[model samples]
Target: MIPEQRRDFIYRYVHEKNVASFNELAELMNVSHMTVRRDILALEEEGKVVLINGGIKLNNLLKLELPWREKAELNHDVKRKMGELAAMLIEPGQTIYLDAGTSIFEVAKAVAASNCFNLTVVTNDFSISHYLMDMPHITLYHTGGLVEKRNRSCLGKSAANFLSTINIDVAFISSSSWDLERGMSTPDEGKASVKEMVLQVSKRRVLVSDSSKFGKYAMFHICALSQLTDIICDTALPDDACQTLAAQNLKLHLVSTEREQNHA
Candidate 1:
């Protein structure tokens, strides 16, 4: 398997099992113990896993947030497809709020690439602001606040104050984890505050996430799933998840990828 896929498989396995021995991982992955150690080291470096005595475990700390670059790489294709689907909801001359997240970054990219112009975009993410700098027709507003380096996003009181002032037509929000029980959550309190404010101010709130995010919980809770106007996810999302969202009367937009289409 490719390195990314291998790493993701390891992550999912460890996450599901909560803990795994070196021998077990090596056997499950069909690789040597050395290869398992190497993959475990990579995941350790990413803060997603912790190496214990002869075993590995998911970080499991509710407040541990992975680095933005690391997460951006985890589900790259799924995120891009979700981004494209999210951009379809945007119209011309609208005021938009883009939350600070790697998944939301894809949405910003799709918006930047589209024919939609003369739009005012407000964001707490420095990278997203920088990405739209060359797009002449877009008016970009940055939420000046404390930076959370791991996520490369702005947060704290200054960001919240700025967000409260603006009226957003559509807000694209992302979270580290979500489920029927926890709703939406993030590790950072400041980021959660900013996201909650954006949801309140926007006329429509759309959540952009991949299937991997399901059945997880974070430290800070934002809002329940029913609050969102819509959610964009790939076809890899489980049927039970779809059923849960549907039961809540929430709109879940399923975007099919080429591989999923072929299988169908």
Candidate 2:
């Protein structure tokens, strides 16, 4: 197997077993111990696993969603660049859906700052709705349901039902955790249902996320990678990860982060 495939195997193996020894993994994959070690190191760098005593284990941190304020602060710059790239896909007269998340909030911010006008913005995020509320040129609609105050979003059967009725020109979706194997996922089924509905009703589906979210998994699956038409992320996304997306024929945009541009 190629390196990417090997790493994916190691990831799944560890995830299933909860913890895996280097010797057992190397034997199971029929690869050398050094090869398994190298793959484990790569996975660790992605924050998907943690090195243990002569073994590796799935990172438990990936299973929980961080609070909104914390997530907003985690990768502020990278999310801004990704949001800028995602916002460029919006047109003046089209209706769009912005999924509830900090990354999608940046997209709303960029759209509000841009020249686009007469656009209708639909969202479940309280923060996004409030951010775009004062813009007279744009029409806004909120998916009202159960308030998930932790993420500052609305979710439930009512929220998902509200999304099913509207046709979206483009939908910018966000995720706390995603990977090649599992696609986009979240810790709550409510969030997953809303996102799943958005994917089904939109003409164009775009995933706006930072590279940090890659190589991670959550408790609930939203949708598979094949469901998306485009993906916007920072250049810190690994080359092999990019190749995996490219091979699937997804439109991938790797924007340069502010830090990278400033250093250049």
Leading candidate by TM-score: 1
Residues 1-264, candidate 2: write the lDDT tens digits: 999888867766664456899999899989999999899998898887899999998785575565677677666877888888888899899999999999999999999999999999999999999999999989999999999998999998999999999999999999868899899888788888899999999999999988767877788888889899999988988999999899886799988867788899
Residue 14 lDDT (model 1): 65
The sequence of per-residue lDDT tens digits that candidate 1 reaches over residues 111-225 is 9999998899999998899999889989999998998887888998889998999999999998768888879988878888898889889999998988767767788888999
In Å, residue 74's CA in model 2 sits off its true spot by 1.4
For model 1, the run of ten residues with the poorest summed lDDT: 60-69
The residue-level lDDT of candidate 1 at 144 comes to 88
Clashing pairs in 2: none
